[model samples]
Target: MRHILVHLDSGERTAVRLALATELATRFGARVTALFAQSDRYGPGIVARRAGPALEEAAAAAKAAAEAACAAAGVACEWWQLLHGERNHVVAETVICARYADLAVFGQYDPAGDAPVPEDLVEQVILNSGRPVLVVPAAGSYATVGRRALVAWNGSREAARALGDSMPFLAGADAVTVLSLRGAVESSVAGRVPPVDIAAHLASHGVTAEVDLVPPNEAGVTNMILNRGADLASDLLVMGAYGNYGFPFGLRGSNTRNILREMTMPVLFAH
Candidate 1:
């Protein structure tokens, strides 16, 4: 990726997100844009009046953290801020900013408290930006990523799109594994096209990958992905952001939601 846009927030996980973004930028010799989005909270006259200053302070702190981190990493970086009067406006601004980026990095939503971006911001950006998103978990520290990568494949349209979008990371990985759960593949096309075709495709792009067909198990697909990811010691997990229709705030399928909730490592998602 040439240009990366990272969502900046004054949350507990902001440092982790900034570290990951700067690492990626340094690795790819890319430019990093740190975006801090401030939103006005709905309240009465007095509460509303005080919200702006607090939000601005949080935004300024987040921007400073990002700037310092990027500078320490010696990466070319720029800062951008969006001041919106509403939550939806924050999401809209993020999506609009992502249009100029090659990849977008965001921290996993923290519902407990102290999150600058909306909880559903990642989902909105994935669906609307037409770009890949790399979500860093709220807990733990990731020192390396895209070194040992795991690709969750199911032969679906979303999975295929994710695979295509992750070519840059795949090509740079030391070892890549493509995992396909049994019964997840469509029967009609199972024999027509093999999973090896995916490896061959990546090979053309200079990515060497090994395919693993996982059998049906009690852990379910989402758990299987996490299990395999841990087993492989994968620093990065690549998967499709599957979503069900009719969701009000976010577009996320069960598996996608589960992974987002429990992931301990960075995940790259495309819808």
Candidate 2:
């Protein structure tokens, strides 16, 4: 909500991440921290030594653009550089930076991009940061966000956390939908507390939400959630990043991974 931390790299979609961060900062009256993190392939070779300056220049350019965008939007901004030294891991460093913010913004993974960021950067941050993360899609332009929202609920602890973390957006949304997947719900408590409980909870926060009790889709839960978001024309999707035990939440869960891979709109995820 406030204290927005956005991850930026030399990737082409860095602007998209900054745009979303600025929009959220303007909406919530928050300060933006643009963290420029890219792996530095430092070594003793001449080519490796030359790559360092290029990376530094790229980081400087990203920082300047982030500051300029924030200034034009009348939002306070801070810049941070997380350098990946020979012994440092980019994912761990990024997660460390994300810990101090209320929400972290990131661009969806682009397999085609030449960005030096680790492929699992976003996933690691979400699992370790203990904060909500909003990921902007890498391919499209989202001029509007958090206006029309879709929340996927399965009554798990992760789902509850996601719902609570997304209260700010839901409370301000023009329309909100809570998609309760029946099969995913615990059978004992399935019929007892339906999506109405969630709707009522949102109502208490001034977020009027309509509930849809959907059965298990033959296709898959992930596809079902994405299809519902597209059908509802939602600008944001809120969901829990379910993970296996002995670790954090389920960023490794297929549902979470699939959704992140095929997401068409921004997704707000919590563990």
Candidate 3:
């Protein structure tokens, strides 16, 4: 990854993702661009301080934090902002910036927190920017990511794209598990590529990967994936961005919304 674009806001988790982006940049010799944005809609979070000096103060603090972190890490860093724009414009600006970077880092939506950005910002950027997005959970201390990765494999084009996009992480991980839903493979088909094939591909790249299968539960595929990620104690989860073009995306088969809502580990998503 040459360039990493991370979203920054007034929320406390800005430090968490900024730390993550700095770590990745140092690891891969990449530059980090901190994009600070705010939503104009009046709702939970910092929307109440939409007008006046308080908002400007918050934005300044966020920018300063990023600058300090990047300076301490000794990585090339740039600052961008969209301080006076509507909610849609904030999301649009973020997406446009992410399109220029190899990977975009975002924080998962916290329904209970006072988020200064749109709740669907991460989803919109991932699905629209044509870039791999790494979403850090809003509540977690991820000092290290991608050491142990759990990849959700469903034999779809989207899944293939995600696997390809996560090569950097996979090649660096100590262990990787290609987790597939039970009965999700076409073992009988002559030209079909199964999870074992995926493992072989990773092996060719010098990444040791194991193939595992799990049955879907009443809670659904997203729950099953999260459960396994917890079981493996993985720091990163690699999956495809399965969703429509708009918000409230009803993803086919697995619900992208549910994954976004319930994901605890940092997930790298590509469409």
Candidate 4:
């Protein structure tokens, strides 16, 4: 919840992307690291001598711009020109793990090749780093973050992490709902520990919340979360973003990116 990492690619640092980062950083007194990862089209080019001095110069200029953005915001920053990797997930993984960023802030992924897949890289950061991600959309602004909120809670480690990290925003909300879906196979030795415990935890923090659970085989848990938020008329949706395992289990979840791409409402996600 403290260190917020921002991608300073394609001139996103000046738009609502950086504005949102400044907003959140100012609120929490957090440091911001604007990472400008070079697009992954250089290795083969260098092999063929296409990546010349011009490309290196451009990389240095990008570094300066990113630094100035952070300086203007009155926070410490680390600017990197990662010139040799995939444009998406590799950079996301590097900063969160290497930089120890508590949270990653990004604008919506408007990829030229595939849109949702790039955005899913953001989801991958949430899942892999076990940290929260605040994604500002292409057309949206930071104005969506305050006032009212919806928290989709399933009583899992992912949900708990999100709930814990989003306290600053949630405490600022109008109404909050800790919604739970999917069945729980619990031990017989203990009573059923419902997701309501989350609501109570939030209540102790002065954030008023309600508890709700959905049945098994419920289609579109993402939709349910949004609908419930709309029912309560919340502005922002806070929830645990579920992702499959990294290697052989890497699967872009339907409930996961479907919620991100289709959600008109903003989602605050943690793994």
Clashes of each: 0, 3, 1, 1
Model 3's C-alpha root-mean-square deviation from the true structure amounts to: 4.6
Clashing pairs in 4: 147-174
In candidate 2, what are the lDDT values of residues 86-132, reduced to their tens digit?
Answer: 32456777889999999999988888877866678888888889999
TM-score-wise, the better of 2 and 3 is: 2
For all predicted structures, in order, the TM-scores are 0.87, 0.89, 0.87, 0.75
- Residue range 1-271, candidate 1, lDDT tens digits: 8999988876777788788889889888898999986456542135443346667778789888988998899998899977543677788988999888999998778678576457788888877888899988887898668899999876667787888888889888999999865343444356766545677788889888898976533246677779888999899999888753212233458788888889978999998
lDDT of 3 at 256: 70
Worst 10 residues of 3 by lDDT: 244-253
- Candidate 4's C-alpha runs over 4 A off are 11-14, 41-72, 85-99, 112-120, 144-146, 182-196, 213-217, 231-233, 243-252
Q: Predictions ranked by TM-score, top down?
A: 2, 1, 3, 4
Which run of 10 residues does model 2 get worst, by summed lDDT? Answer: 243-252
Clashes of 2: 3
Query: Residue 255 in model 2: shift from native, Å?
Result: 0.5
Error of 4 at 98 (Å): 6.6
- Which pairs of residues collide in model 2? 242-250, 243-249, 243-250
Candidate 4 per-residue lDDT, tens place, 1-271, comes to 6777766554443345666676667777898776654444444253542333544565566567656656777877776545444545355645455236777776556664322224355655666766677776566456447577777765556667778878988887777776754343233224556534556778899989776766644565556667887788776777666643111222546566767676766677877
lDDT of 3 by residue, 86-132 (tens): 67778887889899999999999887877667778888898889999
